[model samples]
Target: MVVLKLQSAQFFTAPCEIRSRKRGNGQKFSRIIRCGIAEASGEPAPLGQKTKYNDGPFEKVFMTLFAKKMEKYANSKEQTKKIGWWDFLYDYERFVDASKRVMQGKNRMQQQLVVREVLLSMLPPGAPAQFRKLFPPTKWACEFNASITVPFFQWLVGPSEVVEVEVNGIKQRSGVHIKKCRYLENSGCVGMCVNMCKIPTQDFFTNEFGLPLTMNPNFEDMSCEMIYGQVPPPFEEDPVSKQPCYKDICSMSNPSSSLCPKLLA
Candidate 1:
């Protein structure tokens, strides 16, 4: 008989077991016991256990659009059809790889411009005008926008909820608190998050859509906050732009430099 044990100090719970038995006709029977508490409570699994991500129709639509944009930007001949969770991650990593190649000689502003253009391409025709008309720069508009963002952006940023935040001395539910940013966690590239996602998204909303916005990403926990109707600071003044590489976690990290090399590229 073989027995496997997995214990975690954080989750002090009884061990769940899996048993296999040999039957009379030389056949084998297996019984699997899922962790009931975690499953029922909607909590993450215990330590050392791997979690599988699932994709929905909404996620697939966005992934397809993003992949198409990246494919065009990189001038690749390949077409991406499968937008499953894992496949989407692979495609995102490939886009990052292409960013390095295509943005090698570009300056910081130019790199941001490239990403911003890609973002614009993904949107529908006159989306900015429609968005501006729908959601003006007001507390009620921002709060409604924030509430709807959770469902729309869940695939890219993982689970998130609308949170009340103080903006200009007024409290409003115009903030989205991401439990963990899947883009940051999966890519592990601070530059990619900043240049490819953070800057472009903020600029897209603030400039194109005529709505002020900001994104605060915490590298330590891979969490993030999206605040609508809040003006984002310039790149030179933003602390995120000055953040150094995650040498320990990122595979493409440059330890010798103080900042991520991809920031300029």
Candidate 2:
């Protein structure tokens, strides 16, 4: 009996299947398949499992590259601070921590502006123009954009799927529904999610790339929807601008205030 140990979670003994395949050396390889995670406990698998990354080598490379880029743009002075080499999740947490540090001593508008610059710095030369030309505000363009966002951004946002949304009276698959946002969960700060992520991302896609994008975040569950081809409202008009802090999760949360203290900073 060959044992196929799962690295993620415990497997159910009854809901499993055994299979065999012959290798090139005439060796029989035994494989076991368990019932899908949905039927059991919804402990979602790691993002790397859904990609071509074998044993997390590619994930480590990508995470390291992105983390260095963030630190470079955020002007992080702590050169001695190092993100985890092998632990991608810990690296992500460090990345968010860097973002929070960027917001220190900065007002609301300045925070958003600096984060937007960091995002633009990460992109290649003329990427904004290329994206604008490739993805115009059309049904097919929006749908295709949504489909690609799932795999391309799953590392940062976690598991997400393309969802259908109505834009300008036309139904299109231009929405990306995130199961749970990795950044928000890691930071646990409403201000970080808004200034560092939501506002900067919206500005990057809409202004820089010429593709109007809106992000609607559910602070209660940490789920979010990214709708391409939809213009994000101004901070003065959007309700998220006045959103309260996460009382239990955020260390800087002010329970007495109705709105996030950082929102007024």
Candidate 2, 140-226: lDDT as tens digits: 787777877775565576667789898888788899998777778777889989988898889888899888889999886788999
Against the hidden true structure, what lDDT does model 1 obtain? Answer: 0.68
Candidate 1 off by > 4 Å = 1-51, 75-107
Tens digit per residue, CA lDDT, model 1, 43-102: 433322322334433444565666556655554444434434555444344434555544
Estimate every model's Cα lDDT from 0 to 1.
0.68, 0.70
Error of 2 at 174 (Å): 0.6
Worst 10 residues of 2 by lDDT: 47-56
Per-residue lDDT, model 2, residue 86, is 49
Global CA lDDT computed for model 2 = 0.70
lDDT of 1 at 246: 84
